[model samples]
Target: MPRWEPDARTRLEKAALELFAERGYDGTTVADIAERAGLMKRSFFRYFPDKREALFGGTPLLVGHLEQYVTEAPPGIRPWPLLVDALTGTARFFPEDRETARTRHRVVTANPELREREVLKTATLDDLLRDLLTARGTPPRQAAYLVRLALTMYEQAFTHWLTPADPEPDFTECVATAVGDLERVLGEWGDGG
Candidate 1:
């Protein structure tokens, strides 16, 4: 075994996803993932504290991205546009390759534990977003409502972006489409439909 290997983190992530998909999340062990990545168990710990974290290693970075975007947004920007900008800015954190994303989504959704983890991670994000907005002078109630809308927009955009027939839809464009759909819905209510 080499004393040092570059990109060990990426290698381990790919290995873990492959194993999780193949052997199922519970069936796959930390040792199995490390070995598949051509690393040792110790190396796995160096990257992720546990097996479940391998699928969520990017959570902190994602949280930080939102934090930075919200904090640095232009002074005159309203909460809704800020929310949209913050959410769309996260496009870089996700995989450009749709299949890799689909596989990870599959692995997470297929397991109850993983699904719970996903929910917890999402809640953490939503809470932070609301807090960030409130900190930036948005009313607490409005911040909370914006967070909920952002969550819906993100989910809708991601699902549409992951569609198999799209053949390379841009995540940002998908988000714009969701925003448009939301506007259309709100417009209907305004017209007393």
Candidate 2:
């Protein structure tokens, strides 16, 4: 068996999204993707199961990198900070191809099929994050809560990044700011916490 090549997967993703934008996902086919990628149709099938996955090509890779980098973060680091780091570091995973990113975002947002995968991926990462926090010595209950909050912060961060008026950051600073706000709220509500 051959090792997976980032170059190959990236090519497929770029090709798939381009064609989908030009002719709609329903209008595209695997052959179109392969031709766009400048790859053989056989090679395309070797990498992705079908056309839709070409559009979703990088997600599993993104999730794996997040889990690995985040879980490996030093135990001394607080979980929220660790999450911010992980999300930030994972930024490069998406590529600087703005048109591709924006187009893929629109396709994923608009497509029922892609939305289901995105939601499931979120759920899976949330569970993984809770586990990572607990292993870092957060109380199990606290870890679960913190993971949910951090994910919510990430969501806010993503929304802010998408706003046309907002500044561009590889990873949104607003995410960490949201976390700080949450911390302030928790401190104010302290049951001697």
Candidate 3:
């Protein structure tokens, strides 16, 4: 048997992602992942409820950072900027393991079930953002719109940041560029009116 190691959670995640990439998400099993990580099946269950959860288990961390950032932002900060700050703040939770991220992205994108789970996770974050904004005195409708726009920009920026040609290694730069793009688009739209 392979020697036991520390950082069981990280090891399991890396192993699972690799197996998912090799065998496809549906074809991979908990035992396969655990075995690859040199762990027992029960050890895998301790870290993740299922194979899908292994990929998405960090959602709570991301949501928590966003909530904290939004709630603690300077009182006078505008809604859009607050949203940008909150979104960017959550980027730090992503691991710097680019290849693992790429493989996990491929697996999640390829599976319909995984895609649905991803959408659900995004919606949860959207709801959290909306609630945070509303508690800070924004109207419900405006909060909803702001949350959607911010999430859209975040998604675009994250995708751009992950691209091979993206020169910047930091995720925040991509987010800043996305925010600028959003501002330019809105400016053009307002001018056309």
RMSD of each: 1.3, 4.2, 2.0
TM-score winner among the candidates? 1
Against the unseen true structure, what C-alpha lDDT does each candidate score?
0.91, 0.76, 0.87
Model 3 whole-model lDDT (C-alpha atoms): 0.87
Which digits, one per residue and each the tens of the lDDT, describe model 1 over residues 109-131?
Answer: 99999999999998999999999
lDDT of 2 by residue, 1-193 (tens): 2445458777887888888888887888899888888777788988888888776666777778877987777768887778777876656765575545677878888778878877887898888888877777889998888778777777767666555553465455656666677778789888575
Worst 10 residues of 3 by lDDT: 161-170
Model 2 scores a TM of 0.80
Error of 2 at 31 (Å): 1.8
Full ranking by lDDT: 1, 3, 2
Looking at model 1, residue 71 earns an lDDT score of 90
Select the stronger candidate by lDDT from 1 and 3. 1
Full ranking by TM-score: 1, 3, 2
> Of models 2 and 3, which has the larger lDDT?
3
Clashing pairs in 1: none
TM-score of candidate 3 relative to the true fold: 0.92
Model number with the top lDDT: 1
Look at candidate 3 and give me any clashing residue pairs: none
